[model samples]
Target: MKPSGTASAHSDTFARDHLPPAGQWPELVFDLPELLYPDRLNCGYELLDRTAERFGDDRPAFRSPDGGVWSYGELRDRVDRIAHVLTDDLGVVPGNRVLLRGPTTPWLAACWLAVMKAGAVAVTVLAQQRPTELATICLLARVGHALCDIRSVEDLLKAQVPGLRVTAFGGGAPDDLTQLAAARPGPYRAVDTAADDVALIAFTSGTTGRPKGCMHVHRDVLAIADTFAHHVLRPGPDDVFTGSPPLGFTFGLGGLVIFPLRAGASSLLLEQAGPKQLLPALAAHRVSVLFTAPTAYRLMLDELDGHDLSALRRCVSAGENLPAATWQSWHERTGLRIINGIGATELLHIFISAADEAIRPGTTGTPVPGWQARVVDSDGEELPDGEPGLLAVRGPVGCRYLADERQSQYVRHGWNITGDTYVREPDGYFRYVARADDMIISSGYNIAGPEVEEALLRHPDVVEAAVVGRADELRGQIVAAYVVLREGAEQSADSLCAHVKSELAPHKCPRAIEFLPSLPRTATGKLQRFLLRTSPDPHGRVALE
Candidate 1:
C-alpha cells in the first residue's frame, strides 16, 4: 500500500518528515475491513469520546485501588480539559512532540490522550528511566513540552533538556496541570488529524545500545484493538483489565488503555504491580483479563493458595518467550489457557497470538487476524517448516523508525524482521527458539539459551533461571546458567547441572552455574540476560571440571 496522500493536520511536520523513506517502508496489508480508517481520525477521540458515546457515559472506564472510579463521561471530560490546557496554556502546536513521564495512573493515561487530542505526538517514557536515558529520548524525539508526575519530575528536570517546557501534575500547587485544567471547565474539540499522522513515538527499551524511536500513526493504534483484541482476546464490556506493564511500553498501552477502552471495558491501573501486589489486586478488583510476563505468572503460582482467581478469565503473556512448563503449570492451577504472543517495539502491538482452545502449549500461536508472518532465512527467503530462522511479519502496522538508519535493518523486502529465531510447524504454529543474538555456539553446536532456561525452570527447587553464552577458550562458547532456587532448598550446583544434563543433551548442559537470590529483570519484568552475560563477578562460581 502507498502512503496516505491526504493533507496533513499537523502544523509542525517533523514526525512526518522524519519517517522512513517511502521506498524503504514495509508492505502494509489491510485486508480486514476494520483496518480501513477514515482520513480524519483522532485516536484519542475515537478511543475515549466515541467509546463513551457508544457505551453509556456513566459506565466505569478507569478504577483505582482507593475505590476511585472514573466513568467514561468523567474521563472524557478530564481529557478534554487537559487538551485545552495543552493548546491554550502551553501553546503546543500540532505534530510537536510532548514528553509524558509518570507512573501508570489515570492521570498519566489522561496526559497521553490529551497529547493526541491536541494533535501533538506523545513520547511516553518510563518513570523508572534515569536522567541520562531521559536526555537521550528528549534529544532523539526533539521533545519540547513535558507533563510529568510531581514525584517523577526530578529526573526529567535533572536531564536539562534544552529549551524544554515542563508542566507538573498530581501536585496541589496553583501551577499544577490539574489546577490549570480546572480553569477550562468545558468540552474541547479534538484535532482533526489524518489517520496516517504520527500519534506517538515509542522508544526501544535499549536492551543493547542506544534506543531507536518507533513512530506509529493514529490508525495503527486503533488497528491493534480492532485486529488483535477483536479477533483474539474477544473481551466483553463487563471485563476489568489490569497488568504489570508500565504505560510507557506498547504492550501496556495496548492491553490496559487501548484494548479496554476500545471494547468499552474498564481497567484498573496500578502504579506498583509486582507479583506480590498483583495477587490481591486480581481478587480485590475482580480483574477478568490479565496481561503480564511469564515470570510473573510463575511467581504468582507460588502465592495462589489463598487467592480466588475465579474472576480471572483471560491471561495474556508477552515481552519474553513463555516456556511450555510455565504455561502448563499455570493452566493446571487456574484452568485458564494463557494467550502467548510475540510483539516488538517496532510494531505497535502483538501481531501474532492465540487464545482459548486454539492455543498450542509450546508455540507462539499463529499470525493475528489481518497480519501475515513466516520464518525466513538470512536472505529473506521463506524457510521450510521445522527450520529455525528469522521471524518476519507485515500487516496493517510495521516498523517505521523516525530518522534512524536502523530502519533499513528492521524492514527488508517488505517484511519487518523481528530479531528472534523461530520455527514454523507444518500445522502453522510458530515456535520460538531464542533471540538471534542470544544463541550460544559451543563447539559449533547451536544451542538456544531459552531452551536451557526452560530446562532449569522445570526443576522442583528452581524458582527462576536465565541462560547465556560465556566466552570460553576451549569451547567457542560455554552455556552458563544463573539460577534462583526456592527458599530453604539446599540444591547444590552439581545436582542442578546433573538435572539439566538429564533433561537436555550432555553438550547443552551448563558447564558453569551461579546461584543468585533473584534474576536481573527490567522494570517490565523481562529477564535481562545482557547483564548476566556481562557480569564480572567470579565468586562462588561452580564449573563442571
Candidate 2:
C-alpha cells in the first residue's frame, strides 16, 4: 500500500497504530471518476451538513416512531451539537476509538455522525451483545469513550471495561447525551480529516467465531454510496427508506443511513422491526425502498394480503444469500423485483448487486460500476466461466482488518478473496454456490448446501431449512437437514426425503432429518450455520438409509 498522500488530522493515533502492516493491505482500485476523493474529507459533514446545503435544509432526513421528523437542517444541527459534546466535553480527540451502543434510533444515528465529525474512530456494537462480547470488542479496539442508549447501558456497565468512559443518550437525565447536546446548540466545525484516516471499525457478526474488526476510512464510506447506491440502486431524494438491520451491521448502516442520506432521501428509524412490525410500518410510513434479508421476505409473504404495498418500488436483500425461490415468490406477489446483492463487513457495503431490468433471477448481477470480480480456484488461478470457485473482488474500497492475523487469508495477490464459492457465467453474472466451508462432500459427490436448502424450501410444508455435513464413518460425510415446517404442518422425514430426491439428485438428499421450531440466526438476521452445526442432536448417529 502506498503511503497516504495527506497528513492525518488525528491527535490520538491508536486507530492508525493498530492497523495491519502495509504488506497485509488489499489492493484498492479506483477505476471510476467519482471515486477520486479529495485529501481532506469528512463523511459526516458530506452526508449531513453538505447535503443540507446542496439539497434543501427543510427536507426530511430521519423519522422517529413517535411521529417526530428531523429535517436535514435539524439533523445537521443535532450532529454539530453532539460533536461539541464529544470534543469539548468528553475530551475525545481524533483517532480515539469511541464505542457506540444503542438500538436503531435518531439519537444513535446522531451519535455516529458526531464521532465521525469529530474525527474519532467509531466502534459500533449491537445492543443485544452480552458483557463478554462487549468486553472482547472493547479490548480489541482499545476503546476509551462510549456513547450508549440510556436503556441499554446496563450490559456495557456490566462489561466493566477498564478506563472506559460511558455517556448515555435518549433520556432526560443531566448526564444524558440528549440533555448535553441540547445544552450546547451552537454549530461545531467538522475536523479536516485525511480521507484515508480510519473512520470506523465494524466487527464481523457472531455467525463467525471471534469477530474480526474491519477497518474502513472516510473515503471508503462514501465510495459505497458512489459505487453501489449511485450506479445500481439509483435511489432518489423522494424515496422513504426502512429496513430491519441495526446500525451496527454495515448492511444496515449503508442501506438505512448512508445510502438514503447520500441520495438526499429520508429513512424511518425502527427499534423493533420484525416481519410483523415491518409490514405495518412499510404501509403506514409509505416506505418506497426496503432493505432486509430473504428470511424476512419469506415470512412477510404470508401476511402480504393484509398490508398495502403500493408505495414500495424497490427492495434490497442482503445479510445472507437470497434464494431464487424467495425472489420469484416476492416478484409474483408484489410485482417488484428484489435486488439481490452480496456484501461483507470488511468491504463496508454491497459491492455486487442488480436492480430492476438488469436483474437476472437466481444470479447476483454483475459487479457494480466501480468494482471488478472473478472466480478463482484454491491456488488463486482464474477459473473458467462455468466453473465454481472462490470469489475474488477488487474495488475502490477493500478489506482492512485491524491487528488481525486473518488479514493475509482475506486479501491475496491484491484481491479480496471472499470465502464464498461462486460461478461466473458466460454472461458475466455471478451465481453463488455456497460458502467454501459449506460444501458437503459425501463419498466423491460434491453438493452445495444452499442448493439443497433451496430444494427443501420448494417443499410446501417446509418454512425454512438448513443443511450441514455431519461426520460419517462410511460415506466420509452425510448431508443433515434441520427444518422448520409450516405452522400446524406435519410431514414425516421419509416424505421430506422423497421430496428432495424428486427435486435434486438422490445423493443430495439428507440422510438425517431433524425438525426444529426455528433455525438459529444472529441479531442481524444472518443464519448462524456454526450454531446449527454445533447444536446437539437428540438422536445418535444414523446408519445410511
Candidate 3:
C-alpha cells in the first residue's frame, strides 16, 4: 500500500523506501550499449523464457549430479508454475520480498526465477548460516515470504518473522513446492516489472565482522553476465558449467547459474560439491567450464592422481587471490591456465578478470571489459603503475547498499573504492597486494602481507598461508603468519621464516609464524584475517626457534 512512484510497488515498500539516499549512490556508468536495459523487464523472462525461444525449447539448461538435465523449456515451465503458486496461492504481490534458503538444488534455482517472475524480490541466503545470522538478514530485508528445503530450513524457520508465508520444497512435506507443482504446473505470465525494481539483496560475508545488504536490480543481474561471463568466459550452448560456490554467494550465483543460462549453456548443480566430489562429477558430466575458489583448486590438485580433467576448457578462480604457485601448479597438472580475478559483493560480481590467453600468471589481469578500474591513493587520486594503492572501480553494476552509513565510505565521490590494495603493471595487468586494512606498517615501513604469503606458498612444504599484522609495542605492528604446512613436512617455524627471508625483503618476512592444521576461511574460500587478529593464543606463536 505504498504510494506509487516511478515503478510499481505492490508491497516491497520496506526495501525501496529504506534504500540509501540518491546522492549517496555511486555514479553508475553504463558505457556499453548492452548495459542499457528496457524500462519494463523481468530477468526471469530474459534468463529463462526468451532464452528457451532462441535456443530450441528443448535445449538443455541445468544438469545435476544425479537428477537428469533440465531443458530450457522445462526450466521456464517450472518457473512459471512456481510463480503462479506465489501470486495466486500464497498472496505474493509484485515488489514483495521472498526469502529462499536451500541446498544447491535445481528446485532452489526454480524458486529464484519464480520469485522474480512474480515481480517479487529474492533474498537468497546461505543454507548453512547460523540462526542468528539468518534472523538478522530476515529483519534487514523485511522478508515476508520464504521458500526453503526442509532438510536445511531449521534456521530459516526460526529466523522468519511472523506473518511469513513459508513453503517447504523438499523432504516430502504435505505442502512442499514439489507437491504443489505436481498438482498444477503450467504457463504463468511473468510480471512486466520496471528494470529499476530491486530484484535481489545479496549479503556480504561480514569479513569486517558486520554484514551489509547489497541491493541489485533486474538489469544489474544481466549486466554482470553480459560483462564478465559473456566477454571473459565465452561460454556457448555446448559448454557444461559446474562449480563449488553456494547460490547465496554472488560468485556462485553469477558463475554457476547466470553465466551458463545467459550463453544458452547448462550447468551441473552438485549438492555436496567438495573437491573430492567435484572431480568425479566433472568427468562423469563432462563439465567443460569449472568455477571454484583457489583453495578448492589447490585441494583438487592434491587428489588429481591424473584425474581426467581434459573436459575442462575454462577454469575460473575467484573469491580470493590465486597464488602464483597454485595457478602454476594447476596448469602444470591439468594443462589449463586458471583464470584469476578480483570481485566484490558491492560490485555484484567480477569487474576485473581475464580468461584463456589474456591471463597473466600471478596477476588478476586487467579490468573487465565494460568496466574501468585503477589504483588510487588515499585522496582518491589515481596512482601510477607499480605503486600499490586502493583499487577503485566504476561500472554499470556498482555499490548500492541498503540504508547503511557505510555507503558513503564504500562509495566515495562516485567511485566504489574496493578495500583491496592492488598494484597496476604498465601492461595493464593488476596484481593484488593486500587489503588496505591488511597492510602492515612497522618502523616507518609499509608491507603487504599477501606479498610475503605468496613467497611462503612457493615452498614445497607449504600448503596454505595467511599473513596479518600483529601488534608490537616497539614497531607498532609486525608481519605475522598463520600457515598450514603439508603433513610430515618441515614443521619448524624458523625453517619457514628463513625460507621467506630468502624470497622477500628482510622486513616482509613473518616476524612470528604459527603452523596451523588449517587456515580460517569463509564458506566461499576467502581468508578471514580478522579472526587471526583476535586469536586467543597469540603468545603460542613460535619465537624464532
Supply the TM-score for candidate 3.
0.97
Q: In order, what lDDT does every prediction score?
A: 0.92, 0.91, 0.85
lDDT per residue for candidate 2 within 1-545, as digits (tens), equals: 44386899998887788787888788888889999999999999899888888889999999987778999988988999999999889999999999999899998998899999999999999999999999999999999999999989999999999999999988789998888898985798999999999999999997878899999999999999999999988999999999999999999999989999999999999999899999999999999999999999999999998899999999999988899999999999999999999999989988888998899988988999999999998888999999999999999888888899999999998889999999999999999999988999998999999999999998988889999988779899789899999999985787788889898988999988888888888888888888777777625233336
lDDT for each residue of candidate 3 in 320-363, tens digit (9 for 90 to 100): 88888899998998899888988898888998988888888989
Residue 273 CA error for candidate 3 (Å)? 1.3
Error of 1 at 369 (Å): 0.6
TM-score-superior candidate, 2 or 3: 2
TM-score of candidate 1 versus the correct structure, residues matched by position: 0.98
The alpha-carbon root-mean-square deviation between model 1 and the true structure, to one decimal in Å, is 1.1
User: To one decimal, what is the Cα RMSD in angstroms of model 2 from the true structure?
Assistant: 1.2
TM-score for each model = 0.98, 0.98, 0.97
The deviation in Å at residue 192 for candidate 2 is 0.2
Which parts of model 3 are misplaced by more than 4 Å?
Answer: 1-6, 537-540, 543-545
Cα deviation at 488, candidate 3, in Å, is 2.8
Q: If both were scored by lDDT, which would come out higher, candidate 2 or candidate 3?
A: 2
TM-score of 2: 0.98
Q: On TM-score, who's better, 1 or 3?
A: 1
